[model samples]
Target chain A: MLALDIKHLNKKYEHFQLKDVSFQLEKGYIMGFIGANGAGKTTTIKSILNLIHKDSGEIYILGKEMLEHELELKQEIGSAFGDINFYTRNKIKTLTNVIKKFYRNWNDDAYYNYLKRFNLNENKKIAELSTGMKVKYSLAIALSHGAKLLILDEPTSGLDPVARDNLLDIFQELVEDGEISILFSTHITTDLEKCADYITFIDNGQIINSSEKEEFIDTYRLVNGKEEQMDSIKDQLIAYKKNSFGFTGLIHTKDFDPSWDIKSALPNLEEIMIYFSKKENLHV
Target chain B: MYNLLMKELKLGVNPFFYIMPFLTGALMLIPSWLYFLVLLYFCFLTIPNMFAGYKTQNDLIFTSMLPVTKKDIVKAKVSVIVILELMHILIAMIYGMISVRLYPNLIYLFFKPSFGFWGLCFVMIAIFNLIFISMYYKTAYKYGAATVVSITATILFAGCAEWLGIQNSFVSNLFKGAGTEHLTTHLFILIAGIMIFAIFTIIAYRIAIKRFEKVEI
Candidate 1:
């Protein structure tokens, strides 16, 4: 059974609409969700988590309908969002104690271990904690819950580079367990390169592309050419934006011409995002 | 539910909220404590402080992301308010009981030194909760607007209570009168107070949960 399955999910606001979003995360792979701000990435996740009511669609977690099994389903899912709001009055010890009661698989020892690992004090109030510290606290609780899936929204947004790398490493370790999966939403492309098996890009409330991480990297090629070269090969261009002197185009690697001098190119997720978002106007 | 309740106590609201009522209620003792209605003034301080964290722009997005459901979230908030209201009344009542002991000649202004004053307090809190919770939940996106609406409703409550006290009809009977040296509370009024509390709390919860479900974040 799939760990998560969302089909034809729709939600609308005054300015944004998540139009029939759907995707699945199997039991053992990580899905990176890339989107610009206001792109409905968080909305789609909220629907899957049953945090928001869907106007229409079906979502199943561990093969059980989400609406019918929210409490049970939630027990196995670890969730974090970019905006971390905690009770400012609560000491870290109290927060841990409170979360311990909700999950039967909760490990107090594990939670405390992480507190030490992260060098966080149990007596610190949540309001006094830094953004990076809050993220670590949320993660410590999430990981100790024995959850099978983690739905993290921009979990590393405010962290230092060393801290961010540590989080990515944790995700890598979690995936190796193979019983767990993650749907990580963030602007950090480098993190995706480290652990993502697949990617789905959302822009302006739409999903532009969904594919394996390796394939997403390999599918698009950047070629620099003058106007005449651009003219000769214009039909093959998957995406193109012109500079004053010449045109730079992203061609489908599958359709690339060996005879053409494509010039120097280094492939990466950031370049691909630029190419596609410009290509389809969210074409990624 | 208990887990989330504990979390609410710790992080959702400030400890000062709980302590402020006690401090304010203690102050009433200094003013001959004959001013039983002064407790209403104490309730005023709570509304803004109670909702201080939530009145910000990001609160909607932030609160919705927690493990608790929107329903539970609404319940927790209302519960916190109830706890505060209860704290104020109880502390005031305790001080009321002590004031009478300290100054034997003290006259019971609203209710006699007995069950009547406590009952009045209950009804007052019930009324305030219904109006405050309902208004806040509906106009939640507009924190300034909702605060103003609820504050207006509170003032209206104070005005209406004062009007009833002077006329001394159905409202006068609820609080202790001059004829009754020892105040008494009927079973029905207490029950009605609780029932009203339940109904309004449910209404507020429903409104908030529905609105929360539709929030974009």
Candidate 2:
């Protein structure tokens, strides 16, 4: 079953609008929600979690309608936002005691295990933790409640490379049991590249692409060529950048010119995101 | 619901708020026209400070992440406010009794801190609650306007009541003079005040619930 199904979700503000954005995360896999700043990634996540009211949409979690069954569905879904928005002056022990009471499936053993693994002291106040530790603490809480789905928004935004790699490993392990799924949102595409099985790219409050990670990556190529060759393929390139020496850009594999002496290679997730983001803005 | 209430006790409210009742209740020890000070102390010190703590802690955003509905949140918060208000009144009532006993011959220019005055305190708080809670819940984060409006209402009620009691002879006699000898009359006034407090607060709570339900965190 799909763990999250958001269909035709729309939210409008004075200057921005999320227009009919839709995506689904299948169980037992991680779906990377890729976008730039203000690209509607957080907006979409908030809409699904009902932290903000939507203009019109249907959000289903674990095959149940979200609005009709929020309380029930919320029990099985865990969410971590970019910042640790908990009571910063309170002790972790006190905060946990308060939060655990809301979940029927809260497991003390699991919580203690996470505390040990994350090196989080229960006696320490939330404000005392560093940014990376704060994110770890949030993940610990999300994992402790026996949550079947995890929706993380920019979870790795400020982590060190080692910490980011450690978090990616944890996400992979969580999905190995085939009972948990994650919709991880981040602008840092490398983290997703390391662990995501599927990818959904959102730009300007709309879904630009959603597909298996391998298929999506395979569809694009990074091409490097001399500056004089720019006009030959200017219309065909997804996005391009040129210095005085040379130019490099992304292009669809099908749009390649075989005789141009342009070097082509598989584009990484970051390249794909940059290309798509630039493409979307070019259209505007 | 119990969890939501506990959440408030743990994070939203501060230890100072719990101790504020006893401190403010002590104001009733003065044997003069300071009866209104007891109610004003609570309205001024406790409510605004508690709300400030809530804002500093980002309580609304944190609570929204929990597994409770908006209605549950409003209920829990309103219940906490009522509990605090009751604590202030009950403790001050005890002190009010002691002050009266300690100075039996003291002349009360304003209404004495009697059962009737406690009822008036209830009405004063009810007015504060109706304005403060209803206004605060509209946005949930903007407390300045709510506090100002509610404090203004409380001050007006206390001031008007005190002025009328002193200037209007019939009002003074009914509340503080010979009318004190009639148990049934005072009892009826006290009951009426209590009922008004209950009705006003209940209406405020319902309005708060409706407004808070539409508030997007």
Leading candidate by lDDT = 2
Cα lDDT tens digits for candidate 2, B1-217: 9989988877788888888888888888887766878878877888888888788888887788778888999999999999888898889989888988998887888888777777888889899999999999999988889999999989999999989998999878876777666777777777888888888888999999999988888
lDDT of each: 0.71, 0.87
Docking class of 2: medium
TM-score between candidate 1 and the true structure: 0.85
Best by TM-score: 2
Clashing pairs in 2: none
RMSD of each: 3.7, 1.8
Stretches > 4 Å off in candidate 1: A125-133, A232-236, A254-266, A280-284, B30-37, B54-69, B104-114, B139-147, B167-177, B182-217
* Cα lDDT of model 1 by residue, B164-202, tens digit: 766866566555444334323354544665666667667
